[model samples]
Target: MPAHAPARPLEIAAAGPLRGTVRVPGDKSISHRSLMFGALAIGRTTVDGLLEGEDVLATAAAMRAMGARIDRGDDGRWTIDGVGVGGLMQPEQALDMGNSGTSTRLLMGLLASHRLTATFVGDASLSKRPMGRVIEPLSAMGAEFTASPGGRLPLTMRGLVPAVPIEYTLPVASAQVKSAILLAGLNTPGITTVIEPVPTRDHSERMLAGFGAELTVEPSPAGRVIRIRGEAELKPQSIVVPGDPSSAAFWLVAASIVPGSDVTVLNVGMNPTRSGIVTALRLMGADIEALAEREVGGEPVADLRVRHAPLSGIEVPPDLAPSMIDEYPVLFVAAAFASGRTIARGAEELRVKESDRIAAMAAALSAIGARVEEVEDGMIIDGTGGDPLAGGATITTHLDHRIAMSLSVAAQHCRAPVTLDDAAPVATSYPGFFSTLDALAGVALK
Candidate 1:
């Protein structure tokens, strides 16, 4: 399941109830930040439950290239000895960032003020994604970039030492853009501020504080104002990553859609900023119960017990989009099985993910005989009233891992088998996805 493996087609058929308790991989957001922040800290930082997926591995590789001594122990613990603030070494070669947009964008911020020049290259899919959102802010802080047309990848950037600090307001609610600015502030010489009109996931903010950076968040009339003082050293600490709720989202929706399915996903990160899927599903009458809710690694953790239930579609609130942006593709799958029409709006961000998720999901769903309409910002889906879909189409996943997995879950309630053009992309985030699905359904899907 390597990131650059040959195309592997997958076919999933309607299966019996998916019943079991499963623990997904580590939270991808936390896994990426843990490695980056650990690399920037002054001492040894140890991480447990690190996701060894291709995306997080890409981050680990990038940090190692920039002078972090990172190693994984036999006991599944990763230890990083950071070079401290202003101590990054210039990489000897271009950083190859596989298919991870998170690795590329966040590292752009991490390198913006390091007084080093780095060239970044990625796979074709990542190359097409817009880097301008991150580039615009980091460039404002004095980083010079020579990017592809439209600010795409295969870009060379020269970092600025003693980078200028600025209060940048988000033109969009993107955690990557916000995180890049904060990461750049770590090497800058003054107070760096970001104004987020709508809150996205706050993993960057929380993890920065955990690393002992002088960062603060205050409520603003516009939204949240986050300020980080630059040139501050980070302290290394032990971290235990929680299960990714984004990965857990697939099972939650699967159990809700497939009759007689009951599944419990363990130790899920329930950070309020990233729990919009849970909220939206609850509104749609999904039978999701939070069990053993508690704190883990300074974030809320819960074991989610979901039982099959008839769902009624409802208007997905626009404000919920930021928290659950990555989960929208699968949410559309859940919507397809609900009792009525589901309308999703204010999610234009979906258009720019690994694929145009809105259109991708629309086309894939429609091809399989689900009623879906592609909208500019989002999608409108008419459910089958819990009926199984006629799944005789081969879906093109467009090299998006979420798309591949989301459609796989949709196949659970399909009459025929649903075929994916490529499932290799699933290794980027959830390498164990198919195996886990097999275990839940008690059938081998190949």
Candidate 2:
């Protein structure tokens, strides 16, 4: 069994409006993709602004085991010399992906079509997460998996000889699942297709093309059909990862929900494919100004200047859930302080993420004295609507990164301090979160 050394839990207190210019870390999605694509490409892929979080580091370790050479430069950039398509060597040891579902699932796809066997292990949190979704789809493509009972991790994957391509339609909207199948197709001999009914993040498709993979997307009545021609050589190129929109989401909600607050988050990745939270916040009457919009590394980027606003709640469209699936915890925090009611639908995906986000958010909101109702798929939050939150409680984070960040930010608008238990899990994504927020609040962690 593997153990992670835990950091001391910190208490965050509510303070006045935050004013500062802080550049957030690189995008986690892009960081993971860069390592995956770089490992599968033919030449050295240099990445600038890659997120150095634990989740992404796990992905880098997996790539190194598969025969890719990943090195970090003195200037904080990473360079990867890949093993190329069909060139990966069998790893000598079990791949420990820690608590990263993205790393585990996507690697399953890559392993599914290769001519080797690999075993994956993770922390208790990742070990408990279901791998059945990736297992079932990759199995259909001729991969064999033996997991713990209930399809959990510490699993072994034996790739099939003469692997077959698959036409898979995702039962749920998951980018990890989508990316897994797409990667499996890269080593197969024919066209592999995946149909996503609700649009999830398209970073995989975009990065695949950038790596010189033969991929195409066509709109269909059922959903968007993505087809990739198998057995194509991937050519490596330089990539600059964008700032994480999910991380920016916390700052966005904090600035709008806290009184007398005004802050601008710069160079945020605003890929329309991942902008559901912005749309939802705008619908709830957030005062957000998009400035100097431009393109970077084939994705949209902009400076978001957000100010305190009187927010009112509205029903978030269920179909839009895929774009901002990870932002719901913070969205719930914003909703807790809004004027009316905020209802979320089509969020069954939240049940399987880092923790049961839906349940966690409901409990925390209720604990902080906000009236919250948890539905099977989503939640109904009746806001104090800018009323100072009663917030003298410790929230259990359940090893979920977004949960801890959301509660930490939720304390900003409360009448009392908010403490989250087990915030050490936040290193999976936003590593500098508490220090950054503390700098903004002009206070020390006490």
Candidate 3:
């Protein structure tokens, strides 16, 4: 691993009402799946516009270590020549996934089916997130794990030979766990089924299908049931991952509430499972229009046109949490700039993300003199309604990418610069965030 210098603290002055267009990076969820699916396929898979962030790079490294021939070209494209299903080798070094839970959890599934042994490690943030949810299902498939007592990382996995297939119903709404089980099923001997009560992101299903895996999804009265046939070969694919809606949320909120600011974000993902932010924002009276709607490489995408408008708070249901789980911190930020109050419930998952997002966002917003109430599952934010935020405070980022980005956006309307501890982690999801925002509006950092 390479060590880089820590980020310096900086300030952002309040911006004048503005207008511009910005395009964010490819979707993080889809980007991770691209690599994982490509590695599991039998032939060569080509990927364009993949996010080169550190976290996704960690996934690429882990796949290469698992015997995939993955390489990068000068054209900013990536190619992976896979070792075929069930052909993954036992990695010599412990897989270090850095700050990516998606990468670490999904890799565990692929490892569960083969007859191999491997260890997983990560940075401090990744070390803290519980992996037990994923471990339990994989364990039921006959794999064994030696992990920390509470199932934290620095864990070793012993893959199951003649792995048994399972009809697992998810206890929680997690795309990671569901995808893990489905990936494990790729090499098992029978049908592996997953029942998701609330559908999470569907990238794994769509990409798996595109790669020629035998998968069928049926919506039952019980839930959305997915069945994958085991020991099936996956063909190579040409993938063009869509832009991340989570990354687009910041701009969507900013443009929606900045009062006279208008912007267009091109080629953004409109996956139904991940479009809750757009839906919730529109429910709050956001002025947004979707244009050029089309399907690209098995994912739905469109151009989003947004303009500044008055926003009012609305009650967000717990059932919608799984769709926009990664966008809550910034949604809270948007709520702070809206009219009335925004109440979010059933978001306990926020507690275990890159940081305790609820606590981190609440503390940071309150420090800048915003009135916020943090609840067990979610937060209550009183909007400022275009009023200048009481700034002159530095926010603690806790090394979380969304926290760093959210606070940076809040600084745009604050009285003084809201210096963040380290913004370097933003690269994990939105590598060009600051620069793109800088070009669109006035944001200065020192």
lDDT of 1 at 130: 92
Which one is best on lDDT?
1
Lowest-sum lDDT 10-residue window in model 2: 1-10
Q: What ranges in model 3 sit over 4 Å off?
A: 1-7
Candidate 1 deviant stretches above 4 angstroms: 1-4
RMSD of 1: 1.4
Write model 2 residue lDDT over 1-446, tens digit each, in one string.
46866755878888788777777889999999999889888889999999999999999999998899999999998999998888889999999899899999999999899989999999888888898989998999999999988999889999975689889999988999999999999999989999999888999999999889999999999999999999989998899888899999999999898888888888889999898999999999999998999988899999899998999999999877989999989999999999999998789889988889999999988998999999999999999969888998989888888999999888998888888787899888989988889877764467
Structural similarity to truth (TM-score) of each candidate: 0.99, 0.98, 0.97
Give residue 68's lDDT in candidate 3 (0 to 100).
96
lDDT of 1: 0.94
Residues 1-446 of candidate 3 have per-residue lDDT tens digits of: 33344775656666665477777898889889889888888889999989888889999999999899999899978999999899999899899888999999999999999999999998888888999999999999999999976898889999997899999999989999999999999999989999999889988898888888899999999899999999989999888888999989988987876767889999999999999999989988899899999999878899999988888888887778999999999888888888889998899999999899999999999998788999999999998876768888878888899998888777777777777878888888888888887887876756
Error of 2 at 11 (Å): 0.7
Of the two candidates 2 and 3, the one with more favorable TM-score, higher being better, is 2
lDDT of 2 at 170: 94
Error of 2 at 56 (Å): 0.1
Residue 47 miss distance in model 3 (angstroms)? 0.6
Ranking by lDDT: 1, 2, 3
The lDDT for every candidate, in the order shown, is 0.94, 0.90, 0.88
lDDT for model 2 comes to 0.90
